[model samples]
Target: MKRFLLLACLSGLLSLGCAAQPAATNVPEAIRVEVTGKKNGRPLLLVPGYVAPGEVWREIAAELGRRYQCHVVTLAGTGGMAPLTVAPGASYYATYARALAAYVQQHHLQKPVLVAHQTGGMMALRAATDFPELFGGLILLEALPAPFAVHNPRLTPDSLKLPAREQLLSRLVSMAQGTFLQQQQMFISTWATDTLQQRRLLGWAAQADRTTWANIVYESMTTDLRPALPRLQVPVLLLGIWVAGKAVKPDLTHAQVQPLFERQLAGAGAGGEVRLHDTAREFIMLDDPRWTLTNIEQYLAAHPSKR
Candidate 1:
């Protein structure tokens, strides 16, 4: 499934290049932008999840770009064709948030709206709390307002202990065998229903630095964004997935996740909305980009700019 998708995206890219056309207009190095629409608008910034790049929002961004200038941020040390390092605790989140705020100020973006996914949603919460004046609202996708209970066997404390540097290096070398393909499969099975989109996402993951993958995994396990949620002053939207049946992992129940969001929204004293999509899981955006985009559009419309 993934292989077929990869081939299709590659073919599409080649076709576009051959036809002297572009699929999407990507900013060269500017990770921030001014909001330009039919009417002046607030900037929309997208923050991606662990092991994923800003391109994960490509489809949605292109659609939204018609109405709102969109800026997709790929965290400096995450999945990119660059050297990587382990980001210390909340420092990465804080630093990126500050950088984004500074960019907004520099470009004079009107109270940018942050659209974040997975761990990126946590970072957005931290940013909104720390710099309320720099943001307008937040759209959180598949994020828990509190720390996820460490119950998944694959994400246990013992399982997350950082591998020794040398051991990690060895593992990197071994990853050359079939690790890349395995990573590709893991991403597809986890986030995508369509084989083409799965392959496109896998290609991005394959290009990521080994250290980035390890560090992201380590940070994801240790960092908890619950404390920052109560401090936010901006409006928020929490989009949670509702599994059809009892999850194989009993600890990851929808009931357990709901209270965390409700508590945070109540604490924020900000307009908040929660929607449970029963058919979707952790990667709701990837599974149904149109639905995600529609929800966001309606939210923004309902909360039109005061200016």
Candidate 2:
């Protein structure tokens, strides 16, 4: 059960990396996109992880909006947004990847920078891999190409298991709503330091569609992006948190985390840079706004949209 429990650790935790082509396909209403800031600024997309609402990026987007046109997204089924089930033979991650591609095309974004967190980062990675030309740059927060690699670097994509997601799904299906929320809040508290921020994340969890969340988590955990790292066409900046509230492995330190991230970067060729923070939790923006904002600003400066 080590694999099961460890994989679920971040279920409590926490997406991107787009190109702009033309073609207007209506993005389903389930995935809400809220665009604002700089009438003529560079297109910037911020995607949140797990069951988080678009609100998670509010502060960061507000600041980034000063120079970039910010398009904040609230994915289907979470954040009080409508939930949707993928049709047979389709997965949420793949579907969203296609939708995001359409979004960039429909909106006419020219190689927008994709900034995603956690699950959202995983989804964006899928899109980047499937459509490498969709983005000019990617900035990922508390995201890893594959969680298993952090625990066991020897675990290659070929060795990864796409476990039956039913065990975890059944647990959520049977748990009482109140109890479910309470347990989720506890896990979230460990990952997000601020009580108010914890409450906000829990608020989204409470309203989230459990089935959809489990499905996304299952698809995400089962995915292995390490193999695709070398194929990523855009420059990537990964901002990860090693300290703050890491409950899975209480003794987890920056040293252990840094090497793993560096290992992933080693596979990414010259287009990757990783910066791991020790003081901030998984919810870096909420726990350490200044640090989060500063790193993003620098990444954008280095990978300007003009490219």
Candidate 3:
């Protein structure tokens, strides 16, 4: 989820904002990749959310790395990687999606299992849709094919072009470093229950390229993949969080959530399933590592690659 419901709220609390077209610039961007574990193990590509470093998957990747070769990706424009200068009217989403496809091809991953969260999930979905055969399976962590439209069928990418989110990013980006960090701390506090993890989140947010981050948020909110879902060829698994804990009146039930997930999966010719965690928040892996890993393991086992 963009900013953990700040950008993609199934609750419809935060309306996504639009951005002004970016000017052209000359810069070559590279995604930072960290490969580890058994050289012969099945490739597990891990992608983190907006402003997060690939290390965001450190804890879970470590666990999975014991059995799989994990290629953790920190996309260009964040985590110390130089930001990609998006041309006017161009899409950051497209840039990232293409980058992902190229990475898989360049690395010869042999139908890797892809695990992506939030904006990264959006990117992976686009890439998977465009190059389905490159991946063994798709696992989206708290991501929707059309995040903003999940709660509202009426919303279009054009409709979410509001000012609040974009303005907020502007304000945050303009703030002094100390103040910006404080704002980040406040922004992400609700995303994770762990204070330590919260600090790590803050650290990444601080290191992020403010300009690229703004473009990413705008692009993510404005893009919807539902129409392209029909092109999906690989098996998919959506792991969504219902709430941090307890059943609140507003929090949706499986009966309610399942249908939406099914709708998202309906377009996938290969089909898929959803696993909602009632007790975890946006950072489900950090909140419940065991649950996240176990679910992923099960999915991988059930959908072994057919190379």
**lDDT, candidates in the order shown:** 0.59, 0.72, 0.74
Ranking by TM-score: 2, 3, 1
Clashes per candidate (backbone, < 3 Å): 0, 10, 1
Among the numbered candidates, top TM-score falls to: 2
Off by over 4 Å in 3: 1-28, 164-172, 244-254
Global Cα lDDT for candidate 1 = 0.59
The C-alpha RMSD in Å for every predicted model, in order, reads 10.2, 4.4, 5.3
What does candidate 1's lDDT look like per residue over 1-307, in tens digits? 1112222222222122111221121222313333333345457888876556787787888788888878777765445435423234334454555556656566677877889887677667766776676778899886654433323413434444444434443454355635556645643554555777677666766665555454444344455555455556677898866452233344456676566456545556466777766566456777888789889998899877654
**Where is model 1 more than 4 Å wrong at Cα?**
1-39, 77-90, 150-174, 244-247, 250-257, 260-266, 269-271
lDDT order of candidates, top first: 3, 2, 1
Tens-digit lDDT track of model 3 for 22-125: 12222136477789888899998899878788988988999998899999998887888887866666777767776776777677889888899988898888
Clashing pairs in 1: none
By how many angstroms RMSD does model 3 differ from the true structure? 5.3
Misplaced by over 4 Å in model 2 are 1-26, 156-163, 244-251
User: How far in Å is the alpha carbon of 218 misplaced in model 2?
Assistant: 1.4
Error of 1 at 268 (Å): 2.8
